[model samples]
Target chain A: MKDILTIIFRLTVACLLAGLVMGTVFIATDKAKKHNVHVNEQKVMLSLLGYSAKNPAPASVAMHEVYRYLVGEGEALAMGYLLPLRDGSFSFVTIDLAGGFVAQNPVTLAAEKAGEAEARTAAIAVALGADKPLRYADQTIVVTDGGKRTAYLLPGKFPGFKTFIGAILAIDPDFSILGLEIMEHEEDPGLGAEIDQEYFKNQFKGKPLETVKKLEVVKTPLPEEYLKALEAEKSGLGAAEVASIQKQYQDKDIYALTGATISSRSVTNGVKAMVKKFAYRLAILDRVLAEQHIATPF
Target chain B: MATDKTNLQLVVNGILNENPIFRLVLSMCPAVGISTTVMNGFMLGIAVLFVQVCSSCTIALFKNVIHPRIRIPTYTLTIATWVTVIDMVLAAYLPEAYAKMGIFIKLIVAFAIITMRLEMFASKESVNASFWDGIGMGLGFMFGMMALGFVRELLGMGTLLGYDVLGFKPLLFFVLPLAGFFCVGLMMAFFNYIEIVYKRAKRA
Candidate 1:
């Protein structure tokens, strides 16, 4: 009994000492780990938007101020007022008017510093004079180069095969996909986790949002048409033919990852769900303008 | 079991006479599991070397106080603590490497080779002897894993340390789990054959 008691006492002491040491290390490194995670997230978001800089500067997007955007006010053109990108100079952009929106939107000021909707709104009212009194939220982070609004990114997460996959999807001013970058996932690397691979995600690039509204996953080999379209895409002369092929397949289906059908479908479905919600919200904003017989919110 | 052994002898014993993988045939799971790539094998070997050295030295010092009745749990606690510390520190400092090896590093706690060394050698020997033994055993395992990883990666991916040595893949079967057993078996036989020839040459 005494021997047993002595053994137990020594083991307990050793464990206590070990526990104390581990706790100290954990506490020491906690803040750095959190900072790394946030930076990695921002880096992934920026990379998707074609901005690969380590710090990429900061951007603030004002979705609500965009909601009540003044039309033809001080060189501002509106949404759905089509301009075919105008070759080399997509000069008419949301980014230039961004200066005006930034001056008007207080919530955007707070969003530039931190996230979380309620916290930003409250902080903005306290920091800036709230004559408009902070109603629905409008926040943005728009990066511009030579007066052209290049791209925009939205970070989101949805159910993956065996985990919640977080990713940042980028779209253009014309609501076409700029890129898709997976940030985190826990799917089987051999099969389901190929979602991170460029071969799988490259399909999203340049796909119009109208096509993404009703995405489908086709479980089969790459269709010959797509293969032909890819070959045509490389040669500059086949541009019109490639566009016609795209029009044929556009909204039809995306190829499923080989042997990771569920995982492939998960990403497609999640993207569709998120894009459809954004589309619905845009319709509401457009309807509000249409009711007053306004042509465009540009 | 030589009492008046030199430091060199103690160290060489693990690699040549009593190899954990080939001679003793201990801790084969990780030997096969993580030896998928040379990179995987080398990294896991590095982690195991750290844990093995840490636990062995600590166990050697506490041998007297550690009763036989509770030695298992005591040794386990020692190994687990070191593994956790490495896991956390690597995650905080070297996140990319940690993200790759963290899961495998945690699995090191369940290795029989670590606890086996504590019980078989450290408990019965002087602290210095056990420390050298730990280092020797760790080096032996690391080299063995790297060898396995080299062969596996070469045949599996036509690569070495991720360098594409072969322009085309020779055998994809070598990358699978089943291929691990075949590689370990063939390598074990090859080592044993070398040993038999070496002994015969010495006797002659």
Candidate 2:
């Protein structure tokens, strides 16, 4: 009885000591942890925007000025605070350009509105079974400075990959492609990484929706006869006009990565789907801008 | 085993003969996990050194009063307390290192080396002896981690402690976990070869 009592006494003392020490440590470090997280979020945002500098600012003046200039200043939305998923594995942050506050943990907000968006897209796809079914998130933030409205979608996954792909599609409110940015990819470093280069992504820019649908990587250039046919259809063109117009239909001569043809095709198809879905919205945004008498450099 | 050996001998033993990874093979959980980079290995080593020395001394000082039946649990709680303290310190002052180490910092509690040394040596040894043993073992663990990290960073990333080395063109395969296993395995073999030669010389 005495031995058992002594064991219990020892265990109790050890447990109490351990709890007291751990509690003190947790209390001491809580503030620092929060500060580190804030700084890390800023760094991640800068990297996503393709800034490669190690420290964002010098040690002399305030760093907040730099952050404001780079990421823009506004009240951070409460809902934008990234929360750990139920499984405690991954977290996501959402930036709302239109609402002027970045919203974190958009997965929860997305889940809330998924039903309506799903129904609408499903109805549209079902009606046009001939056209491919493309899924797009609702409540995306559209950034508009003057006349141009640019919508930035969050990085999302495509089929046949375990990791998410980061892509940004910029459309000129008139349903024409202005630019495209693929920030990062994990497909195959050198081979698949080529998708981010201007040579590949530039094909989409300045292309209208109707003309973009016929885009394909062809080996042989289009014959002179096809050019003659296209030119003859639209007459009364000056020398400079003919040259510029002829340059527009030049083949989108994208060379596929040697062994990574599938990955290359995946990005190409992803671009097409994104353009097709946003074309109508781009037109609507253009109409809105025109009505407001905004002059945008498209 | 020489009782008359000086502090320098103890240091050498910690780094070579009594290496916590290759020789003793304790505290491998963090050794393997945080050994991908020199910075991570160095920080983890410091953290482990602090915990091992403090906990060993505490355990040795209180060895007389602790009941045998609940001794293991008592040692665990004591080690856990030290780990939490170290974790908090890292988070507060060394936030970058803490963020990089991430979940491994918390897992320091489960490192077998701390509890093993406490139960096997510290509980029966003098306070001074336990302290030195902790230092030696901690240094050994640190050295092993750093060695693994150096190879990985240099070969895999073509950088040493994040500095560009060999003109920055690196073999990507070395940065992955599989390369870590191979590097450590080859290093252990090299250590074993040295040990064999030393043992033969001593016998002669």
Candidate 3:
């Protein structure tokens, strides 16, 4: 009995001592570690935005510069009006006054609307800097200076071999892809890591979203009609012919990775979904811009 | 088991005779986890060496006062404390290595080999003997892990550390955890073959 008690007592003391030492060490190093994490997060964000700097200068300086260059001198109202959803959610629906793309966050709206109406309203109130809870029908406008071209934030799910990989696909108003930034993935490195490469991502850029309707993985050389349509579209002279031309080439196939069929298909489907979602939003944006008499450069 | 052994014998024993991974087959978790890259294996090995040496000395000194029933837990606490210290120092000085090692550094607490040595040998032996034993065992673990890491990194990624040795056409399958099974299997078989030949020669 005495021996057992002694063992327990010794173990408890040892554990306490170990905890104290570890706690002290962690506390001493917490500041430096937090700074590293902050820096790394900024680096990932910059990479997603296609900024090629290997290492950003510093958080305060780099973030300020990025905001200045991207946001420009325009105040929040100059960007566009905020749309409150039925669930009391809000979006910064901006059409670029400059001749570029527009940006919208559909996921953010969907996330806010995911519960009871009252809960969602409460969440929105917190998000929008309001002390009192607002109803879904309330007309509350929060303003911000929107400078960058608006890209439709499409939810992307690529193939990860083990599971469906999720990402955020940013697309331009004309249905062309702006970027495919991976938000989450469980893919193996050197193989799935290839998805993050610029070459693969660049292929989706400038391609019409409608191309994903009948997506197929084929060899690189598309059919002759598709090539002709592409040339005609590039020339911009055959506007009348573009509809039929696009329809015929719509069923055309795209090249897939040699051995990685699942990964290829996932990317193809992910792109398709983004295109479909963006196409719907583009129509809405076009109507809103025309109705509001907003002069869009695009 | 050699009592009157010189320093060279102790080193040789660590490298060959009583290798922590192949012979004792201890601390298999970190050995496999950090063995994905040569640099990771090297860094982890050095860290383990420091912890083992320091913990062994401390445990051996306190062996007299520590009750027999609580010896295991006491040893574990000492090892855990040392590992936490090593983890902090690495995080401060070598952030890159710290990131690469990831959760494996914290896992050093559960590395059975360190605690096993402390309880089995260090607690019973003199401080000097325990110190040498710790060094020997730590080196043995390091050798095994490094060997596994070298082969895996070379074959899997076509690189040593992060350098592209061959033209960077990596065998992607080799980077996955499944690849570790094949590597350890082949190495074990090779060791067994060598052992068989050595036994046959001794009999002859």
Top candidate on DockQ is 1
DockQ of 2: 0.54
RMSD of 2: 14.8
List model 1 lDDT by residue over B1-204, tens digit each.
524777789779877788888778789898877788888877877888889888889888888887788889888899999998888888788878877888789889989888999889888878888888888888778888888999999998899998889978999999988898899999999999998899999999
Tens-place lDDT per residue, model 1, A115-179, is 44455445545544544233432322333544455555556688998989887777766667777
In candidate 3 the C-alpha lDDT for residue B169 amounts to 53
lDDT of 3 at B166: 86
DockQ, all candidates in order: 0.63, 0.54, 0.45
iRMSD per model? 1.2, 1.3, 1.6
Please, what are the lDDT tens digits per residue for candidate 3 over residues B88-133? 8677656787776645667678888888888777887888877888
* Candidate structures ordered by lDDT, highest first: 1, 3, 2
Worst 10 residues of 3 chain A by lDDT: A61-70
For model 3, which pairs clash?
A: A76-A144, A76-A145, A101-A150, A102-A150, A102-A151, A103-A150, A103-A151, A218-A254
Deviation (Å) of A130 in candidate 1: 18
Candidate 3 per-residue C-alpha lDDT over A187-259 given as tens digits, one digit per residue, 9 for 90 to 100: 5555655555543443454456566666666646444554454456345537567557655544455445545
Pick by TM-score: 1 or 3, better one: 1
What's the residue-level lDDT of B147 in candidate 2? Answer: 90
